[model samples]
Target: MSSSKTIVLRSSDGETFVVDEVVAVESQTIKHMIEDGCADTSIPLPNVTSKILSKVIEYCKKHVETPNSDERSLKRILNPLILTL
Candidate 1:
């Protein structure tokens, strides 16, 4: 569904991640920025490390694919993410 739409995320470590526009806008902050027409170009996340950003993206992808996922299951899945951070 996200054929030609994409957004670039520049991580604090100077790593750039080109993600689907729909996926990138999962963050409420990004959604608001998009709604306000303030995020036309690459979005900079100066505080998030590349490792954390990657994990967050992975999590968002999983969540998006399973919108009605059980909370307990999510917690189990997320425990590793939490432990890593």
Candidate 2:
């Protein structure tokens, strides 16, 4: 069987998005599901929008695919530090 898992999320506009479990786990709500054994089925995210949801997924995918290990990743992850200075 495939070790990969999928999650279903519902947008505020009534759209459903099927995303990878890893990506979905980026959210605390979904993370809790995995930890509590409630991730076997589609997760209902009634507060999110499709546009914002897509952006979040994109960020998670980028982080998973090419995790910043050196300066670049560090900078991207902590860019706010520069502005705070």
Q: Which candidate achieves the best TM-score against the true structure?
A: 1
Candidate 1 RMSD computed on C-alpha atoms after optimal superposition onto the true structure: 1.8
Model 1, total clashes: 0
Candidate 2's TM-score reads 0.67
Taking the tens digit of each residue's C-alpha lDDT, what string does model 2 give over 1-85?
Answer: 1228788877777778888877777677778977887656666667877776776666666666666467778568546544443
* 1-85 per-residue lDDT for model 1 (tens digits): 4547887887899998888777777788766767787766878889989998898887777777777889898997799888888
Which pairs clash in the backbone of model 2?
Answer: none
Worst 10 residues of 1 by lDDT: 1-10
Cα lDDT computed for each candidate against the true fold: 0.80, 0.69
RMSD (CA, angstroms), candidate 2: 5.4
